[model samples]
Target: MEPTQWTLTETFQFPAEYGKAVSAQEVKVTAGYTEHQTEDAVRLSGIYHVAANVGFDGEGKEATLDSDAILIDDVDVQDQSGYFEYAVPLLVDLPTSADGQLTATVIDASATATDDGSLAVMWTVEAKLANVEAVAQNVEGELTKTALATDETAKESKQEVAQVTEETTTAAVTPDLESSQVETVTGYVDDNEMLAFINDLEDDVTVTSFRLNDVFVE
Candidate 1:
């Protein structure tokens, strides 16, 4: 399957002085599949909101942050994006506490005055994801399969009509028949067997593990 490339772009405006940093609150965030910009497909979209407590200093205003959230289309963005998605959050050069909470940082801000005589600062953030692959279909539960590779002798053997069975018995069975079954089962012995592989996309790591459940002839 071919990998689908994705890019995320976000832009918003905040209030600030020419040289001072500005904090933005309730910044509108929107995202969608770049392909939708030109193609006709069910576009993926995301929503987010930024909030902060505003304080004015001289002619400039600073913000004490309150709440910021990025929602994935219809799915809630968790601290950890489990299984199939990756979420990497960066607060620029802002400081964070031991528990991973943003403390404070002064943003170098610029502002534009609105019709109501209010200064609006602006900000833009973007990210590019490469080789982001999505599986075409999901396989669930457990699958059990057996592969059969008959030997040359078994392939050349002729089959005789089986007797109608109330006790369940074959008309004829030979060492060659048993030997063919043994070869088929042993074919898997030297081959590489994989039980499961885990890809931790959030952390950019992959792990492969193997386990032997059972190998028996009934």
Candidate 2:
């Protein structure tokens, strides 16, 4: 038989709205997973993935700024204060039995100016998540059944003979487990700080929406 593969993805938003602004200079992301054992010798595992769209606001001395790698201003040199979008991928592993959990952490964040000093960027990270590569196996085995019968017969002149009969059968079995679950999570640098910064920016920086992808092959 051929082995098949599948993937599940989910998206999340932080600071849900722009009006509730905060101030920050940098953003960081972290990933984690879980594991377990099945009735069979085979091990069960869960894989996790994380990503984010960072929002930034820049100002002061007309400088350049980079938000999670997105370039805010380069050609136009001036006191820059605006938001930019940036994203990155994170991964981890764990042993999962019937079902496993997946989550995301903001870790940390901040804002700053780029080379040539073109902007006072306001930065924030909105985390994205996905649970991937979860696996399960059939371990316990199959069940068998058997039956026996006995009979007596008389032959020629009161002679008796004994006879026996037997029957056997087997059936496959299914694993004792429930369906796996997929979820979405968010991590923020500092809501108060981000709000404080956004309140001051000339314009609010927008973060791209999160997305989820699920793939399966049989």
Candidate 3:
């Protein structure tokens, strides 16, 4: 989007403690400010440093005085219909949103001594405002699906195991079952498959060791 350009002018008087100046010369001005977006406007707040050489009390002696003045301004982009409108596109591409960049540069300044023992200062600033398209990313959809599938599979397996346990416990006892035997079995796991499965889990999960057919697998 093209940048929007504008000019800002401000005038203010110094405090009375500086004394009435017979002559004020060699005026210098500098500014430091910050900008932010607020709803349909860009708000600016900062301070301006004004310095000048002053001759006071009808004497030839001159002294340099420096003063800081606060500056605040806002640029409202609301149209007559009460809707935010702009010539350039916004960073988020939305009206009524403050997402942009604003910069100001000092253009001109002047100082004058007033009859009330104070110095008057005036300055002009040139500002440029612009915004770019916002960047966005979508990363959670696939992970969320995978997590849901894993949870559903685990739940189904648990239900099947519970059903089998209940059926076995309810079966009638037989005399031929006087001698029962226990069996121990071991199984092998593919290292690459195990590593890949572990890697797919959430970062917060910690897998120490698991048992497969009475054998511990790490």
Model 2: how far residue 151 lies from native, Å: 64
lDDT of 1 by residue, 95-160 (tens): 121221111222222333233322243434343222223221222111211112244335445232
Task: Write the residue-wise lDDT of candidate 3 on 1-218 in tens digits.
Answer: 23333333333332233333545555666656666566666666666555555444533233343354221111121121111111211122113233356565567867665554444555666655442332112236667788999999999999999999888877744433433321111113456668889999997887876566777568
Q: What are the C-alpha RMSDs, in order, of all predicted structures?
A: 33.8, 47.0, 26.5
Our model 3 lands, by Cα RMSD against the true structure, at: 26.5
Q: Rank the candidates by lDDT, best first.
A: 3, 2, 1
Model 3 earns a TM-score of 0.34
Better of 2 and 3 by TM-score: 3
Better candidate by lDDT, 2 or 3: 3
Q: What clash pairs does model 1 have?
A: 14-121, 26-50
Off by over 4 Å in 1: 1-44, 56-119, 130-218
Which 10-residue window of candidate 3 scores lowest in summed lDDT? 80-89
For model 3, how many clashes? Answer: 1
- Per-model TM-score on C-alpha atoms: 0.19, 0.21, 0.34
Residue 157 of model 3: what lDDT?
A: 100
Most TM-score-accurate candidate: 3
Runs in model 2 deviating more than 4 A are 1-79, 94-99, 114-218
